[model samples]
Every structure is written in structure tokens, then in C-alpha cells.
Target chain A: MATGWKYRTAEAETAEAIDRRCEPRRPLGLRFALMRIRVETELCQGHGRCYMLAPDLFYADDDGYCHPTGERTVPAELADQARRALMNCPEDAIILTEET
Target chain B: MTDAKKYSLEPPEVARNPHDTYREIRDNAPVAELAGRSQTGAVTLSRHEDVMRAFQTPEVFSSDPGAIEIGNIRPLVPLQIDPPHHRKHRKALDPLFAPKQMSKHEPRVRELIRDLIDKVVDQGHCNFHDDIAEPLPSTIFLELLGLPVSRVDEFLALKDGIIRPPARSMEERQEKVKATGQKIYAALEEVVEARMAQREDDFLSTLIDAEVEGQPLSRDDVVDIGYLFFLAGLDTVSASLECMVAFLAQNPGHRQRLVDEPEVIPHAVEEMLRYESPVASAARITAIDTEVNGCPISAGTRIQVLIGSANTDERAWDGPDEVDFDRESKKHIAFGAGVHRCLGSHLARMELRVALEEWHARVPHYRLADGLELQFSQGIRQIDNLKLVW
Candidate 1:
């Protein structure tokens, strides 16, 4: 595990991200596709931002490269974090996909 | 913008202060040609978008042998290897430098910082560059590589010879670097042979036992890999520390923020890395004839991806010139981007964060020495005369 020093910003961002998520998400009836985070293994250069930002949704392997945390679908609470991870990845390896 | 402008990076003026020059080139000519240097036809991509494009499209922009000459007999492993093969080496090596792996060394790193700080804390002033910035990283890296820390001066000299050779002409520079390169190879060979005879608890021993693509790395392969790590581990963090400390010395408000709020050190490090960009530029070769933002480049043309410019490009960030520790999204590529991004970034970040934490705790207030002008090194922006007073 990386030291707690790295999480200071993540903790602060989590609150802001969650607050933004509370602006009434799209109606379930209109939401036809299910959203999930995907780790494109080939593209990942192990920058480690994804796992650092979204620890619950993502985890690192022995090589410190990212891997999905058992579940691919982004939990309602983790949506903001998933997006934050996606946005911060230098390699653009993280993908948020809609499953039809 | 249609014609590639010529800019010489060899000048001491640009070396001392590059942000203005970088901004000028970025604004006027995104793709500029090298005015003076050994790599004659080399061109630089100053725009953030183009730099990122080069990193992403490695097929078009390669890191193969012809990219740059650094006195290496063989291509430095992984750094010179592109895709497919690059992946194998990374898989075997990435785990060694991971954040978790690197964090284990934090305590010792902190201790080293305290020791270095203790020596100068009582004094009203100290040469931050010589007394602290230079020694800290080299000592730590020496331990990591299983090399004797006693010979750090010798090792650093060899690295400087290749990176910043003192010479009147390009021929002289290459000749000096080549001779230094021979010495470096001999040194690596001596240690590698020792490790082979009896394995030890070090990176070299691990690499010797570890496999790339299920085959053990050859003796030459280990030397090549060490060749890259030798240059990288010894210099990069030292340069980063100098740059960051120099920035803080000039900016008291920013310095106070770290002392007041220790938690912001991590973010501040990232922001400074983005702003300082000590590594400056990365070398690559045009693998195929490609056009960058309407400027057509021929195949095999040397490319200098100006990372310093990219981190500050307005198109990439809002208020790019502003240095904000609390900046919301720091996707800056101070560690470059794409597949060939810096492997030691995790370790580098840990070192920077811990060093800053300890320095502020000990010497909270410091400013550049009176009448002292900092002259940054040409390739890697290290300050040899970064004197500071509290």
C-alpha cells in the first residue's frame, strides 16, 4: 500500500465528487445501458493513478499495474471516483463503458 | 507555423531560464528545428498536443538506437526497446519500482533527509545543491543498485561525463562520453560478475535471476539495463529536488504553505514537478514520415519532445502559468506519458515528498543567497550553486 500522504487530496476530492453526484442522476427508466469501468490491460503503463484515486473500484497487481476489483460495474457510490480515475490516467488506459 | 523555426537549446541563456523560451517557441512555432547540436536535423515539438501525440504514436516516433547518442554500446534496455519487447521488460521490472515496493524505503529516505538537514540546520545558510540535493538521491540510488556508496563521486562523474561533457566541439564531446562510457561499462561489468558468482539482495541480483519473456537476461542485457538506470537514478530526483527547492526559496508564500499544511506537500510536489520539469525533453526518432500539426517531418528525423513546454501549454490547462498546489486535476506529464513513461516515477515521488516534508520541518524559511544567480545544467536542469539562507 502507498503511504497515507498520497490520499489527502483523494479524500478531499471524494467529498466534492460525491456532492456533484448528488445532483439527481439520470432516471433509471431512461438509462438503458449499464455503466462499468474497464481496465484496458494492454494500454496500461502502470502509472498507478487509477488505483490510487479509486482504490475500491480498482487495485494493482504484483507489478503495480491496475486491475478491476472483482466487479466491473461501477457501484452508485463509486461513480465519481471511477470518473476521477478515468480523467487522471496519463495513458488513457481507463475506460467507462455502457453495456447494452 | 507552416515553416519549422530554428531554436538552439545549447545556449546558456536558455539553460539558466527556459520557461520564457519554451513559451515563445510554443506560441510562435509548435514544431521547431535544432539550430546547434550533434543531432543536426533534430526538431523539437513544443506544443502539449504534439508532444502527447509523439508519446502516444510510438510507431511513428520511436526510441530505437538512432534517437539519441548517449555513449551506450547497446541500446539501453526498455528505454530503447519499443512495444512487444518493451512490455516484457516492463512486466519483469515494474514491480521493483512500484509505490508499494518504493514505500518500504521511505523510512530510510526520511532518515537520510534528517541527517543531511542536521548537518546544515544549525548554520544560518548552506549550499542546498551541493550539501543536500545532489547527495541525497545518489546515496539512496547507490544503495538500491547494491553499489558501494563510497564510490558515488566516481559514479556521478561518469554520469555527468555522458550527460554534460565539457568539450569545445561535438567530436570532442562524443570522444569524452565514449571514454567515460567505457569506464561505466567496466564498472558495471565488475559488479555484475560479482553478483553472478554469488547472488545478493539487490536490483542487479534480482535482474540476474529474473526472466524476461521466460528467458534469463544475458550479461550484456543486465549491463544495458543498468546503463539506463545508472544515468536515470543518479540524476533525475536530484535535479527535481534542486528545481523544487529553488522555486520555494524564491516564493516565500509557497514555502510557508508547506510548513503550515504538511498534507499539501504531495500535491505541491506534483505541481512543482509540472512547473519545474527538470527532465525538460525526451528524445525520439521519427520511425515513419509523419506530420505534426501541418509541419511535415521526414522519417528518421530526431525529435525532442519538450516535456517542460507541454506541462505549461495553455491548451492543456487553464491558467497554465499559475502554480497551484491545490490544482484539481494534475494530468501533467512531468513523467512523460504513454507506454514509455518514466518507470521510476513512484520512487521519484516518494523521495521528493519525504525530502520536502523533512526540509520544511527543519528549515521552514529560506531564500536564495544574496547576489547569487543560479545556472542550471544543460540537459537535466540541476543547479550546482543553489545557495540558500534562512
Candidate 2:
């Protein structure tokens, strides 16, 4: 257990992140879909680099621990920045997926 | 040679570029010993992996040894306190410095930056350190702590002594450091007491009402914490600014690249912070007997983590000495890591980012002023004066 932690990932979770960029895309909805960004709670140390890199996509809790905004699916125009945010997370907690 | 005799954090050599000295130490004895602090009192760890290991496991490697690094001055709250207690302070204080607040304060920060830049943009030449870098952080820090900006010079002078006392002998330096610490406490006590009566939306007020481990902090606790924030906040940003400006002045192509494409500024700032970390060395101690890479560290022994050296360790970073702004996944220990990471990092980044943004926006070309020596303090990498000309 991470001592003195209010926000954390489960015991079974791993810090290694999965980026869906290299995966084969199935053209179903004509490229307009909500991109699901997941946070592995256990791995997130709340460094807030995601917020710093791309504030439009992430926010911090009262304890200053960062949280992805409720609206995870970003526009195609912001896809690049969203990827940068995922890449810049100090803790490998953020994952980008092109799902419904 | 003995561990203590093998290396020195002193001047003559270190005054030139501590990074070079750190690389030398990290290459051979990665965990170099702190001079005058006994044979086994404290060991300086320079490799990125080793530094991270110690910072992460503060349960074994205690941070309460900041006083030793600060010339045996009184212990700083939160910074010197180990986990659980440290977490409590951070929980209450971290939110105030979050990214949310960065946006809230961006305009004011930009205003401050522009105001400073305006003073010298027309002159075509100015002392970058004093005119711009030094004032920006100090002003923000003072406002956050609710300290009077009118006392900026006073606070800066006190900070200088607190971080790097000006004495040759170790004993004399320690004594002066003690006096400076006492003086700062005496001055801040009155301010804290007044804030206790009528609180404001400032750091001191927040701390005054803040609970650590479900209990309100005592007057002394608040003062100690404030002391740490002032010392930690003021000079570090200034030192970094000097280093960055000095680097840019020498490397016109890098500066021109930023001038051409401002998008690269954030990554460039990260590289700069990693390359020229102002808070180069941080002190820790062993809470219990432990082993670091087979080093048998005993309890109560001081351990100095050479953050500057770790960032330059070739084992961790490719071409560690070279500043590559476009370098992918640049993870430097400039802000340390793990639970005890710097609370003001977000603000520091914003300040540096803003400084670069506004400076480049207006003064696109500048160079180091000729024929003047760039003098920096030994402990904290600070240039008292940095002259720049367009």
C-alpha cells in the first residue's frame, strides 16, 4: 500500500501504459468518436505533467492530484496534444484508446 | 584516498561548472562523501538510478537532514519531515500551487514579466539576473506567503545566508547560518502572529489553519514551514533563470530556434532545468541501516543526493552533458522524485515558461555582456548579476 495516499490505483494494476496508436484502426464511425482515455489509479502519482502539457484535457483534485477531465474523448484536431499528454505523464497512468 | 578526501564541493574547481565536477564524481565514486561531515556522516549519490532509489524510499533515507545541507540551520517543516507528516502538509498546500492556480495567476505573472522586460527592452542591454529573473519569483513567493514585497531585498539577503552563508571556515559558516535562521524566525513570527488574528488567502494563512495528521500546526511549525518555502522558492528560480539566460546568450542557435518556434519552449525549459539545476544537491539521512548498490549505510548517517550529477549521468541520459531540447522522455531529478518531490515545480515551470515566452516575444536576440565575470554561489547555483546585451 502507498502510505498516505488518497487517490491510487488498485493492487493488481501495473504502471506500464498501453498506447493504441500502433493498433490497426477499424473504420466504423467515420473518424468521429469519443476517444476513451483511461487512468490506472494505482500508477498515478499526481505529478500533474498531463495537466501542464495539456490543461484542456486534464485537471487536478483538491489535493493537487491530477485527474483526466470527465470528457475524455478529444476532437481529432486535439489528438496530437492528447497523445503528448499521455506521453508526458510522470507516472505511466494515462492510456489513449480509440473506442466508442 | 579516503571517501571524504577524494572529492570536495568547494570552490576554485566547482566555481567554473559544477556539472563537470559532478560528472567526474559520478563517473568514479558515484556516492561521494560530503567534506567536513565525518568519514561516514554523509555520502553524495550522483547516478539517476541511485538518486531516485533514495528519494523514493524516504522511510529509509530521511529528509530531516536538510539542516545539514543548509549549514546546520534549523530544520525546515515538511521539507525536513519524513512521510505521513510530509504528506499532510503537502495535502493542504499542494492545491494552492496546482495547475489551476497557474492559469489563475498567468496574467499577473505575464504582467510581472512584461513589466520587468519593459524596463530593459528599450535599453538594448541589461543585467538579466537582477532586472528580470531575480524579481519575478521573489514577488510571487512573497505574495503567496503574504510577506511584504517591500521587504524583497531583506528577504533575499536572508535567503542568501540561509542557503549559502558567506564564511570560509565550516564552523564560522555554521554560526552565521544559525544567526540568519534566528533572525528570519524573529521577523516572520510577528507576521505569522498577525495573520493568526486576521487571515488572508495566502500560504501562511492556509498553513496557519492547516492540519497535519488531523491536528492543527503549532506557531513554531508554521514558522519553520514558511522559512523553508522562502528559502526554497526565492533563489532557486532566480539561479535557474541566470543559468538559462547565460546558456542562451552563449548558444545563439538554440535561442534562435526558440525564437523561430515558440512551441519548443516547454521541452527546452525541461532540458534547461535538467542541464543546469540550481538546487544541485539535496541532503538526506538513513533512518535505519540500509544498503545502496551494496553500500552498507548505517543509521543516523547523512546522505547528500547530488541531483545535478544524477541529471548528467551518462548511464541514465544519452549525451548527458549536451542540452537536447527535442530529447524524448527527458526525466531529470531537477525536482527530485517520489513523495518528497518539489511542491513548487508547477509554479517554477510556469515562471520559466513565461519568462522565456515573454522574453522571446519581445527581445528576440541578446548575448552575454562582455568583459564581466559571471559569479555564482557554491551551494546554490546563483549568479548575483548576469549582464546581457542585445
Candidate 3:
């Protein structure tokens, strides 16, 4: 026969379990968000203008081909510039999106 | 042009039909001397065998004085360094650009390529240079260097000043180029300083911490290497892609082949590199007196290896002028050779493959806009404006 209820130590709970228990009560505004840029290769001619303009967000291949970096965490000041790079691509290869 | 006279090195014959000129040179004089302002004269190796031999033997032909003059700005690293020393610098950076290492970034590259294609797939009309080629690599370069994306305009202007100097006096061009170099140097310095303070996980930070022989690289070394990576990664690849697109627009059948058989992209890329080499010529100083194609060359003599001509040489390739994606024996000097071979070769191939694959997959039919004026600059072969309609 069970005496009553089981007592679990603080260390016994996993992050997922804590999240599941607190999810319903927590407010949505406190959650972290993410944003990303998408590139369409068919449109890209590898002009490398993006690389020239935004060395931080773009890189090129040995043949002067262009590709985006994985981490798209734009700084507050650089958001507008990143957007411009996306908008100005001669190939229209870049697409920007935000996710919650 | 008379057969006896040397070819003027200035104002590269971008507009002239390259094939006709190449044929004339090949028939009249396979090896001719090139006269330029800075260097008195250099032997021009036009035939494929000669060019291949010259590029392969770096000890004999050195890329020390640069393939072409870029006014006042110092020549970028690795590209300007001859063997031994060049190998050391290349060794330091090669691992970062290996095929397997670059493959890790493929998904991101594919994503960029796809998004770019989607934008103009519906429009059916777009200026490819402005819409695609120019921006894609520019953005990519910035991201790799860990610089501020906001400074792209500044970067473009500086790169243009160096790569495409305004049609002005030499002195004026030199002044502008020097200023541009200083700006780039300052920017790189600032990035290095900031990264050192924060010690973040980025390429810039890694470079800052990189040591050679138990000593960290000097500020100038960092700046020079950074400059090389920027220019090499940006301009050459961009120009090659532009040429590829232009060729596809002109040759519907070849373009259709790529569309129908995506598996042939890698081979197709090799063929394109052979057909339209962006780097037309590279200069090398004769380290020792050497004889090329039976002509004796003295030490210190500059030699211009015509890579574009080599790609089209009749002896090396069948129907070399034609864009045959199915060519069985396709070996090209597009990425150069030996110790000085491009460190980013794999990266360049991946980019080209992805660009061609995604482009053909989306826009199955496209044509160059009629009456579109094509402008070509010296030292680099790239279309200034490429208007397209699909």
C-alpha cells in the first residue's frame, strides 16, 4: 500500500517536463523568436554583389558563386541593410521571414 | 594587327570575337610577346599545351607580380605569392574551403538559390546582373567575413574602385584605389579588434587567433588575406556565373540538356569552365631562364598564360569552342594548377552547380533580351548587364 504521493527532487525534472508543466500558465510574449533568409539558386547568377555588400551575411564559392550563412541573427542596426540586400538582388534570390 | 608586332596588353579585347582573334594568333604566331606600360614585355602562351605547362610548373612561371596590375593597391595574398611561401598561406586556409567542408553549407546555398529563382519566375523578365549575380555573392562574401551587412554599399564601391576603376587617368585611378584599400583595411582592422575582444565563434575570430610558427599573424597579414578572400571569392565566381547564364540564353539546346538531365550539372560546369573561362590570362615572372614552345625566355621576364585560349585550344579539346556538356575528356585551367591553384575550387564548383541546377529547374525557357548592350572590363571577363526574359 502506498503511504501517499511520491516526492521528486528538483534535479529529477527534465527541461521538457518543466516546459510541459509550465506551458499553459506562461504568457506567449516571453517566448523567443527567429528569422531567416531564403535564396533561390535558379535566379542567382553568382554576381557576388551580396558578398561585396554584406560580407557578414553572405559568402561566395571558388567560382565567385554566392551562398548565405546559416546563422541569420541580424543585429538591430543591420536589419535594414540585410533587407536591402534581399530586395536588391538582381536575381531576386533572397527571401526574408520571421518565425515565432 | 600585324603578325610581327606585339599585342597591346591594355584594353582587353572583350568586344572582339575571341575565336577569330584566337585563330589568327594560333595560325600566325602561337607564341607572341605582349607589350604593356608597367612591364616592358611578356611572352603570351596561347596554345593549350603551352598554357598548361606554364601553369603547372609554378617554379618556372611565378604569379609574384600579379596576373594583371590593379593600380596602387597591393596584390592580394596567395594569388600574388609564388610557390613555397604561397603554399604555406594556402595550407592555412585550404581546410576551410575543402569540398567536404563546403558541402556542409550546401543546404543554405540551395535555399538562397531557390528563393532567388522564385522571385523572377513569374515576372519572366529581369536584369540578371542586378537581380541575381551581383547581389548573391556580395551578400555571401559579407556573411563569410563576419562583417556588417549594412556596409555592402561601401564594400561594393570599394571593390569597384579596385576591380573596375573609372575611365580616368592612371593617377586618378590610383588615388581612388588607394583610398578604397585604406577603407577596407580599416574595416577589417575594426572587425578584428571587436572579435578579439569578444572571442566569438566566427571565421574572423578564428583567423585572429590563428598562429603560424608560434606567432600570430600581423594586422597587415590579416588585412591582405581578408582582401584576397573577398576579391577572389566575389569577382571571379560572379563573372563565371554571368558567362554561364549568357551562354545558356544563347544556346537553347544546351540549356535544355541541363534542364532535362540534372545529373549532368557537374560535367556541365566543367564544360562551361572550359568554354568561357572568366580569368582569361594570368601573369607569371620567369623565375629562371626557361624555354616555352621552343622560345627562350629570360629570368624576370613576365609571361601571360592565356587561360581562355588554352580552354579553347583545338589540340586539347574536341569542338572546344562549342558548349558540349557531354565532353568525355574535359581538363581545364579555369581554377589554375599546382600549388597556386585556387583554394576555393570546390566551393566555386558547388556554387556553379547549385546555380545552374536550380536555375534550369525553375526557368526552363529563357532568352537574352534583344539589343541588350554587353559591356566588358579589362583583367576580368563579365557582362556588365545581362537582361533576360523567360
The most accurate candidate by TM-score is 1
- Residue A76 local lDDT, model 2: 71
**2 or 3, which is superior by TM-score?**
2
Residues B257-344 of candidate 2: C-alpha lDDT, one tens digit per residue: 8899787787788889888887887778888998877677778878878888888888877888888887664467687777778888
lDDT of 1 by residue, A12-75 (tens): 3553453344333443654555667676776787777776667655655667677543225565
Task: Look at candidate 1 and tell me the lDDT of residue B4.
Answer: 44
lDDT of 1 by residue, B69-140 (tens): 789989898899998788899888899997768888999999999999999999989998789998999999
Most accurate candidate by lDDT: 1
lDDT of 3 at B230: 68
The docking quality of candidate 1, as DockQ, is 0.33
What lDDT score goes with residue B355 in model 3? 84
Candidate 3 residue lDDT tens string, B85-158: 77566656765775546677778778887888888889989888777777666666677778777887777777
Report lDDT (Cα) of residue B250, candidate 2: 87
- Residue pair clashes in candidate 2: A8-A41, A9-A41, A9-A42, B42-B302
Better of 1 and 2 by DockQ: 1
Q: Please list the Cα RMSD from the true structure of every candidate, rounded to 1 decimal place.
A: 4.8, 7.3, 17.8
Q: Candidate 2: deviation at residue B384, Å?
A: 1.4
Docking class of 1: acceptable
User: Which model is ahead, 2 or 3, in terms of DockQ?
Assistant: 2
Q: DockQ each candidate and list the results.
A: 0.33, 0.18, 0.01
Q: Model 3 Cα displacement at B305 (Å)?
A: 1.6
Interface RMSD of every candidate? 6.1, 10.8, 22.8
Q: In terms of DockQ, which candidate is strongest? A: 1
